[model samples]
Target chain A: MTSSDNTERLVHVPLGERAYDILIGPGLIGRAGGEISTRIKGRKAAIVTDEHVGALYLDPLMDSLQTDGIEAVSISLPPGEKTKSFDSLTKVCDVLLEARIERNDTVIALGGGVIGDLTGFAAGIVRRGVRFVQIPTSLLSQVDSSVGGKTGINTRHGKNLVGIFNQPDLVLADTDVLNTLSEREFRAGYAEVAKYGLIDKPDFFEWLENNWKEVFSGGAARIEAIATSCQAKADVVVADERENGRRALLNLGHTFGHALEAATEYDSRRLVHGEGVSIGMVLAHQFSARLNLASPDDAARVEAHLKAVGLPTRIDEIPGELPSTEFLMDAIAQDKKVKGGKLTFILTRGIGQSFVADDVPASEVISFLEEKRKK
Target chain B: MTSSDNTERLVHVPLGERAYDILIGPGLIGRAGGEISTRIKGRKAAIVTDEHVGALYLDPLMDSLQTDGIEAVSISLPPGEKTKSFDSLTKVCDVLLEARIERNDTVIALGGGVIGDLTGFAAGIVRRGVRFVQIPTSLLSQVDSSVGGKTGINTRHGKNLVGIFNQPDLVLADTDVLNTLSEREFRAGYAEVAKYGLIDKPDFFEWLENNWKEVFSGGAARIEAIATSCQAKADVVVADERENGRRALLNLGHTFGHALEAATEYDSRRLVHGEGVSIGMVLAHQFSARLNLASPDDAARVEAHLKAVGLPTRIDEIPGELPSTEFLMDAIAQDKKVKGGKLTFILTRGIGQSFVADDVPASEVISFLEEKRKK
Candidate 1:
C-alpha cells in the first residue's frame, strides 16, 4: 500500500446535476483546504467536528483549509452516537443561521459517521440547502456513510428513521486519519469494507480475506479498501439514489444488524454498529442456507472470514444477556425496511450475489432466530 | 369556477422524474382516493390531517380510497401553525412506521398548509422517503404551499429552518373545501393569488382586480385563481426548485411578511400568513418606491387592490401593538433568505416585473420600517 497509488483513487457519485466526488488519499486532511476551495470558491466554511476528533485533527484541517485562504469557523461537540440528536442538529443549524452562512457557503463535516450525518443533514435543510463537504475520519464512515447522501439523527423510535437523502458536494476520505482509530474501532469499520464485497464483489471479498491485516496496518491497502467500498456504494447509489431497488442491496446486513443493535439498546459497549453488521451479515448467509437459498458451506465461509478479522459473527458473540427471540422479532418488525408488515432481507444466492427478498415470511425468521438462540 | 373549467386547469410541475400534476377542482376530495390510487397503484395510504379538516372530510376520503381497494389509515391533529412542530412531525413519522408503510405506499396530507407541511416533511424523512399526496383544503395552501415541494416544521430558530424539499406524487386541491374557510381566510388566500400577477403577470393581476368578488363567491373564479397561482408557482419552482435564482421571486412579499409574522409572534388572530403577506406585499412596493426601484403609483395600485379585496395593506392593519423596529430588524436578519448577513429581498421595477435584490443594506430596511410604523 503506497501513498502514490491511494492518492489517485477518486469515486464519483453521479447524481445528474447534483453529482459529487469522493477522493481517497493518504493526506487529504492536510490538502483539504486546497481541495475544498476549488469546489466552493471564495465561500467561508463551518467545520463541525466532535471533541475527540477535534483534539486529534481539527488544527490540521483548519490549517489545510487556510492554505487557500478558506477561512473556516469550527464547532466541536462531545463525541459519540448520542451527539447526533435533534437538539444537536438544532444547535448546529442555529449557529450556521446566526452566522448567516450563504447558500454557497460550505459546512464541513470533519469526524466519523455521527458528525458526517449530523452536519450533512444540517447542510441539506439550512436555507433549504447549502453545499457540504464530508471529511470522514474513521474507516467505517469513509467506506460507508460518508459516500451516501443519507444524513440523519436518531429519534425516540429508532436509528436513522428520520433523515433526508442529502448528498455532499465533496467527500475527502483521508486514510491518514484511520491510524488514530483504536483496533476495535478499526475492526468495526472493516465490517463495512467487507460489506461491499459481500454485497456483489466476490473478487473483492476474496481480496479482503487476503489483505485484511494489511488494511489494518494502514497505507495503500486501507485506501484501496475504502476506495473500493466507496465506488461500490457510489455505483449502487447512483443507480438508485432514493433506495427504490439496488440501493437496498447496500443494506445487505443492516436488517438483522439493526435488530441486534436495538436488542442491545444501542449500547455500543455491548455491541457496536459494525459488529452488529458483522453478525447480521453472517446471519443473512446462514438464514439463506436455512432456506436453501445458499449452501451451508458458503455461510460457514462467510462466518469464518468475519471471525478471522475478529468481528462478531453470531448473536451470542454479543456481550451480556440478549433479549428474547420475540423481542428481536419485534425489533425486526419495527425495522424501517419492513414493507407492509412483511420481512424484507437482502438474502444471498451465493457469496457476493445478493438480492432483495421482499415479503420473506416473518414466522420463518422468528423460527430461525429461535434456533440460533439455542446455539 | 365550473367543475369542467376547474378540472381542466391542471398545473403540471415539471421536475423530471419527480414531476406531478396538481388537480384543482370541486369535489376532488371525494375523488381523492380514486385519483391517488390510479397514480401509486395497489399501495396502502396513510392520510394525515387536522381535527378541523378531519371532522369535515376524513370519512369521505377514506370511503373514496376504499373504493379503489386502497386501504387507508388516518391520523388527525389539532389545526393551526402550531401543528407544524418537530414533535408533531415525530408523532406522524412514528405512526407511519408503526403502520409499516412501504416506500411506495402513499401518505396523504389531508388538511391545510400546517398539516400538509407537517405530513410532507414526515413522509420525506420516514424510511428516507415515501410516496406522498397533498390534499390541501385552505385557500392559502391551495394557491401556495401545496403546489411547491417545500415541506418543513417551525423551530425555535425560525420557520422552515429544518425541512426538506419533498415533492408529492399528487396534489388534490378541491375547490369545494374553500367553502369551509372563513371570509378572512379566503381574503388571505386571495393575497397570494394577486401575488402571482404582481410578480410577473400584469394581465393576471388586472384580471384579479375584476374577478375578486367572484373568486370569493367560489365557482369558476375560485378554481381559476388557485390553478393559475399553482401554474405561476410551478413555472418558478420548475425553473429553480431550490430557489437559487428565479425562484427567489416567489418570495416577493415573504421576507417582509415573515418578519411581520415573527413580530406578531405568529399570532394568526392578529395576522395570518396571507394577511402578513398582504401587508408585506404593500410594504415591498412602498420600499421599492422609496428606493426609486419602482414608482409611487405602482405601490398605491398594489395597496388599493389589496384593500379592495379586504386584505390588510398597511402596517397598522395588524391588530395589537407591534414590536419595536429593532426587534423586527432582528427577525428580518434571521430570515432564511438572508445570505451572508446581507438582506435579500424581491424588489419590483413595476407591476409584473420583480427581481432578486441581494445585499440590500439593513439600515435602509430599518428606516423604511420606522416610517411605516408611524403610519
Candidate 2:
C-alpha cells in the first residue's frame, strides 16, 4: 500500500499459546525492546548476541531500550555457527537463570540466523519456555531464516539437528544492519529472494530479475523487495506454521541446500548458506527437468539469472569433491521429508510453481546427481 | 455419560498446528499405535523406552503393534532421572535419523516421566517437530506431564532447563504400568493429582482425599482417577496451552517443587517429585495462611492427607539440611513465575480456586519458609 505501511508487516506464527509475530522493516531492532516488553508484561529483558554484533550495536540498542525505561541484560555468545551447540545453549540458560529471568521475561536474539535460532531455542527450553524477539543482523537471516518459526542448534550429525520451532514474540529486521555485511555476503542473500519466485510468485521473481541491482545496492527498493518476499513467506507460514502442506513448497531448494551445507560440513569460509542455496537452486532445476516437470530452457534461464547476479549456479563452484550420488541420496533421504521411508521432493512445474513429489524413487535422485557429476 | 463414553474422554490440546488429542481411559498404551497411526498417517513407528520399561513390557507392547501389522522399532535409553541429559538426547536423535524417520513417522515414548520428557523433547527438536505418542508409564507422567505439550531435557542450571512445549498426537495412559512402580513412586505421582484440585478443582481433591487409599491400593477407581486428572489438565491446556493464563494454575506447587528439586539436585531417591510437591503444597498453604487467603485448618488438611499417603508434607522430612530461605528464594526467583525479577506465587483463596500473586515480596516468601521451618 502506502509508504507508511511499507515500514512494517506482521507475520503471525500459528502456535496458539506460543504463537508470536515476526515484525519486518527498517529501524525495527531499535523499537523491538518496547514492542516485546508489551507482550511479556512488565518483565525485564535479556539480549543474546554474538561478539561481532555485540561490539558494533549492543550499546546503542541497549540505550534505545533504556530511553524507554526498559531494563535489559545482554549476554554475548561467541560468533559463528559453532556457537549453536548444546554447550552454548547451556551457558546462555545459565546466564538467564542467574540473571533471574522468569517465564514472563523475554530474551532478545540479536545477530544472524545462528544467533536467533540458538537464542530462540534456548528460550523455548529455559524454565520450560520463555518469550523471545529476533533482531536478525544478516541478509540470510532477514529474508529467510528469521521469518520462519524454525529455531535450532547444530549437532554432530548435521546443522539444526537439535532445536525447536519456537517462534519469537516479535522479529525486528532492520535493513540498516545489511550495511555491515560484505559485498559477497550481500549478493548471497539474493539467492533466497530469487527462490521466492522459483518456488512461487513468478512476478516477484521477474521483478527481482529486473531490480536485482537495486535490491543488492541497498536502496528503498531493496527493503521493499525483501519485505514482499517476507510477506509471501509469512502468508504461507500463517497458514501452515509447522510446515505441513502448502508451507512445504517453501522448501524448493532446501533439500538440496541442506545436503550441500552438510557436504561442506557447514563451513562458512568455503560456503555461505545463500551461496549453497544458489547452487542448490540450479540442482533443483536439473532435478525438475529430469522428472519432466520443467523444460531445459527453463533450467538454462535459472542458471543464467543466478550467474548474472554473481550467485553460484553450478555444482563445480562448490569446494568439496562430489560425494557419490548414493551418498547424496542417503543424506537427502535422512531429511524430514522422508515419510514412510519414501523421500519427498519439492519439484518445480515451470518457474514460479512448485509441488511436493513424494513418490519419486530414490534411484532417480541418485541417477540425477550422477548425471550432474559426470557433466 | 453412557458406558462407552465413560470408558474414554478426549481432551483436545488447542495448539491448532501442534494440536493433539489426549485420550484418557484404560488399555490406552496397548492400542496407542493404532489410534496414533491414524493421526500420523504412517505404519512405521519407533518406540522410545527406558531400560526399566523395556525389560518389563516392551515386548507385549511391540506385540500389540505388530498384531495390527504396524512395523515398530524400539530404542531404549537407560533408566533414571540422570539419563535425560544432553548426551542421551543426541543418542536418541541419532537413532531416529539413522532409522530414516520421516515427518509422518510416529515416535512412541514409553516409560516414566523421564522417558516421556526426553522422548518428547527429542521428537520436537528432531526435524523441527514430529509426531510423538506419550505412553506414560508412571503416575506423574500419566496425570500431568504427558498431556501437556511441554517436553525438554535438563541442563546443569536446573531440571527441565532445555525443552519445548511439543504436544503428542495421543497420550496413552495404561493403569497396568503402575504395577511396576514402588509405593514411593506412586505416592509421588499422586502429588500432581492433588495439584489439579489445589489449583482449580477442589472437587477432584475432595474425591482424591476420600479415595486415596483405594487408588494407592490399585482399585478400578485408580483408572478413573488418573483419567479424570488428565481430562481436567487437557481441558485447561486446550484453552490456554502456553501457560499464559489458566495454564499458570497448573503450576500451583511447581515453584516450591522446582526449588526442592534443585536443592536435592533432582535426586528422586532423596526427594521424589510428589514428595517435593507435597512439601511445596504445605509451604504454599503456609503462605496462603500468612497472606490470609486460606484457613490454617485448610493447610493442616493438606499436610495431614499428604502424610497419610506416605508423602513428605514438610521440608524437614526431606533427608538433608534444607537450604536457607535465601537459597530457596534464589531458585524460585529463577522459576518461570518471575517477571521483572518479581515472583508470581500461585496462592489459593481456598481449595479449587487459585490466583497468581505476583506482588508477593521475595522477603515475605523467605519469612514464610522460615516460619514453616520453625514449625
Candidate 3:
C-alpha cells in the first residue's frame, strides 16, 4: 500500500518475519533492483529463471541490480514444467553454493510457477535456508503458487510431492510481464485468477465475468484482478500457511487438475497446466452437483466464463488420446492430497463455497472420471 | 524430571506445535515401538538407519513394531558423513515416495548424526515434510544433532551447507544404545556433553569434572547426563529454533570443531565429530585466554580434562598431513559458520561462559592455528 504509483496495490502475507508484500503493478520488475537492494542490503543474490522469461526480462533485471550496486548471478534454465525436477533443483543449489552465496544472501525466483517453486525450494534447503524473493511473471504463479510458500519439484509419482513451505521476503507480481504471454498461456493463467473467485470470492468472479476483456487489455483492471487474487491467497496463507486446514480450500480444482495433468503425461501441448485446471474446476463443480453438493447451473456458469476466456473445460477438449478411467484413478490415488489411501478433495456446496472433503470415496471418483471422459 | 524409575528422565523441547520429548533411559529402544505407535497412531513409518547401527538394532526395532501392530519399512544406508550427499538424499526421497508415504506418516531416523541428518532432511523435503521422529542411537546424536531440527546433507562445497530446520515429533535418546559404542566414539560424544556445561552452566561443568568417570560407567548417572544435555539443547532450541541468535551459543565449540573436521577430511578415524569438538572446545578456551578474555589456567584445565578422557586436545593429535595455517584458515573460511568471508567464533570467558564473537580477525585465527599446530 506504500507506493507512489496510483495504479499499483500491495497485499501483505502476515507471517511475521517470513511475511512479505505482493506488489501488483504495471512495471514493478524494472524498478525491483532498487527495491531488492534496499531489502537485502549488500548481500549477493542468485537469480533463477527459465529460458523463455529469461530471454525477455533477465537483462533488465540484472541491469536494475547493477544500477543499485547489487551484483547478481543469473541462471537461466530450460523453460517448462519438466524443468521442475530433482536434477534442476540440484543444479540450482550447486550454483548458489559454488557462488559461495552466504547464508545472509538472497535467491530471486524470476519466472512462473516452476521457477518460483524450484528456486524457493533451493533457497529453503540450501544452507538450511537463505533469504528468497519471488518475482512471478505468469498469472498462475502471480495469483497462486508464488504467494503460498509451497515450493517443490514434481516427482514421477505426483506433482509437488517433494518440497518445502518456504515464504519469500518479497513478491513482485508485475502485470507488465504478463503482456508477453501467448494467448493460450494468458488464458491458462486466467484459469487461476478466476479460481480465486470460485474458491471464495464469487463477487470477484462476477467482476471478471463482466470486465474480463479489460483484464486482457492490460491496465488497471488487470492489476485489480491480480491484486484481488493475491489478497485472497494472502488471507488463506496467513490463516493456514502450511495447508493443514483452511488453506486446502485454495485447491478448489487441484485434485482433479493434477490427475488430469498426470494422465496427459504433463504434456503442455496436450493440456497445459491452466487448461487442465480449467477442466478440473468445471469437473469439480459438476462432480459436486453429482454428489448433490451444488446445483448443475453453478457448474455451467463456471464452464461458460472459462470458455469465454478460451480455456478448456472438458477432457475431450485436449488434443491427444486421453488415458482410461483406471489410469486417471491411479493418478488420483497418487495425489499428495490422498491421505492414507482415502480421497481428500476440495468440494463445493455452491460457487465460492469450497470446503475440504476428506471422506470422498474412490468409487465415486472413478465413476465421475468415466462419465466425464466419455465425452 | 518426574519419573517412576530413577534410571529414566524426560527432557522436553518446548517448541509449541514443534515441541517433543527426549526420553532417556535403559532399554527404551525395545519399548520404542509402543511409544511410537501411541504417539503417531497407526500411521506407517519408514525407518532410516545406517548399516552399522542396523546390524546392531534393526531386527529388534522391527520386532518391537510388530508387537504393536505398527507396520514399518526400513532403509539402511552406509554410515558416515560421506553418505550425506545429493545422491543419498534423492534415493531416500524416492523410496518414501515409492512407499506412498503420506504427509502424516512417520520417518524414524534410527542411527547417528549422519542417519538422523539424512533422514530428517529427507522428511523435511518429502511431501514438503513428513512427520519425523528421531530415535538416535549414538551419544553424539542423542545429545545434540537429533534435538535440533537442523536436517541436511553435505554438498561438494561443505558439510551441512544444505538443510532445513524441521523439528521432530519426538526424540528417543535411549542410553542403552551407547553401551555398544567404541570407546573413541563414546569419548567423542562426551565432548558435546561437556560443551553445554562450558556454554553457561559452570556448576554443571564442575559436576561433569567430578562425575565424568561414573558417566562413562553408565546407569543412572549416564541417564542424568544425557537428560541434562538434552534439556540444555531443548531450552536453546525452544528459545531460538532457527539458530538466529541465542541458539548460536550451542555452537560453542562447533565453529572450531567443524573447521578441524574439515581439516581431517571428516574422517571418523583421524577426527570424529566429538573429538573435533573436544579439541575445538580446548582451542576456543585457549584463544579466549590468548585474547585476555579468560585465564590461561582455565584453558589448561579444559585441555587437561579432555586429554584425560582420551579426546584430542590439539591439532597434533590428528593423524596424517594437515594443511598450513593458510590452508586451515581457508578451510575455516569455507565453513558454513563463515558469514560473508568474515570469521565468527564462539569464544569463552572461562569455564561455563561462552559468547558469540562476530568480528574475530582472520589474522588472529591464522596465528592461533599456527601456535596450536606447533603443539
For candidate 3, the per-residue lDDT at B353 reads 86
Estimate, for each residue in B49-89, the C-alpha lDDT of model 2 and write its tens digit: 98888998799889888877778888988889888888888
Q: Name the lDDT of candidate 3.
A: 0.86
- Give the candidate number with the greatest DockQ: 3
lDDT of 3 by residue, B112-180 (tens): 999999999999889888889889998999888988788888888888888898899988888888989
Model 3 vs truth, CA RMSD:
2.2
Number of colliding residue pairs in each model:
4, 1, 2
DockQ for the candidates, in order: 0.55, 0.56, 0.85
TM-score of chain B of 2: 0.93
Residue-level lDDT tens digits of model 1 in B11-94: 889899999999888888788877887789646889899998899999999999988888789899988887888679768987
C-alpha-based local distance difference test score of model 2:
0.79
Model 3's i-RMS, to one decimal, reads: 0.9
- Cα displacement (angstroms), candidate 2, residue B308, comes to 3.5
- Stretches off by above 4 angstroms in model 1 are A1-8, A41-43, A66-78, A287-297, A323-330, A359-375, B1-8, B66-74, B289-295, B319-331, B359-375
Stretches > 4 Å off in candidate 2: A1-43, A75-79, A257-271, A286-292, A319-321, A361-375, B1-39, B198-203, B253-270, B286-292, B315-334, B351-354, B361-371
Model 3 misplaced regions, further than 4 Å: A1-6, B1-6
